[model samples]
Target: MVDRTPCASTTAFAQMAGLDSKTPHPTSIVVHRQSRVLEIEFDQGSAFRLPFELLRVYSPSAEVRGHGPGQEVLQIGKRGVDIVALEPVGNYAVQPRFSDGHATGLYSWDYLYWLGVNQETLWNDYLKRLEAAGASRE
Candidate 1:
């Protein structure tokens, strides 16, 4: 089963992140566990359904992103990962506790928006990287 908990409001999150008026904010967020996708609607008239695997592999936590450039750790075996919980972090971000026990990533509003906007490119890139590294998303 999945917990479709409510995330923080984009308006409040953007304000906490010190973003300007032109920035797009999330109007709604829905986690569809059956499909393993996160559907998000932006206030700027845009919407995206991001996959759970995408979010897991691209997590911005230090464990995944590493301490700096050239130190990223590739994620694997996350195709079946699920979000066990989603908690708000102040008003700027949300912390998701993935079933894999990864809970360190604090996905900020800006980062989430970026992920939604560039999901295709990012997905392609991730696939290429995995292939090059002789890895698999399974």
Candidate 2:
């Protein structure tokens, strides 16, 4: 198996990819809890708003998922979660410390962008599955 541990080389690669593997200079991050959206604004006026449900379901924590493929844990009861903090992870990603104490996920820029782009489809699919399972984000 390939080592997924973060190392010097990986750090370097993450930095080179414009992922800010260390610290990213974001002007602001706004969270609309009611709308379930988190907005990130950079110094260059480029910004994106991501859905809370999507972020929660795709959290990068072992509690939500294992370290390898096909180990993802289905998250539930996080529809109204909010972003409590945004901590920088070196210069590659941002550790979105959620109010639920889910601070282990390091959301890289690419991942965040992907989440924004696919929010609707992902959220809908999640909701559909939840409905099929008779589950709700409680």
Candidate 3:
């Protein structure tokens, strides 16, 4: 059998050194509302851009995701909304305060990177769902 147990000493050393073997961190973020895109720049100079509408709809706030799972508040009229501010949430993520004063949610680095990578398909699907529900971004 293979040795699957983690070396405690090594793990402790890595943790103490802040060397997380799990994920990479983001260096910067830029949101372009006019282009409907949110860009995330990594420490390696790699970057990706996601759509504004997708980010708005997927906002991680009680205003968007109510108290429980089924109590989600559907966001509307956020098509061309811009990111007014990007507040740092410790060293892990950023709270993108929108022009609409939606500064409640904290978007993690991993989540932001995922959003950028999957923006196109997710945004298209969101638009379709909106149309089906007779909702307009206007």
Best by lDDT: 1
Writing each residue's lDDT as its tens digit, candidate 1 over 24-130 gives: 77788888999988888888888999898899999989999999999999897888999888888875677888999999998877788889889999999999999
The predictions' CA RMSDs to the true structure, in order, are 9.4, 5.9, 6.9
Candidate 2 residue lDDT tens string, 1-138: 997889998777666444663334467767686776889776655677887768888886677778678886777788768887777776546787777778888776666656666777878888887888888888
What overall lDDT goes with each candidate model? Answer: 0.85, 0.73, 0.73
- For model 3, residues 1-138, the per-residue Cα lDDT tens digits are 999777999777554333455545777666675786777787756688766667778886778879888997668798777787777866666788787778888677666766777777878877887888899888
Using TM-score as the measure, the top candidate is 1
Reference-based lDDT, residue 53, model 1: 89
lDDT of 3 at 124: 82
Runs in model 2 with CA error above 4 Å?
Answer: 1-28, 32-36, 41-47
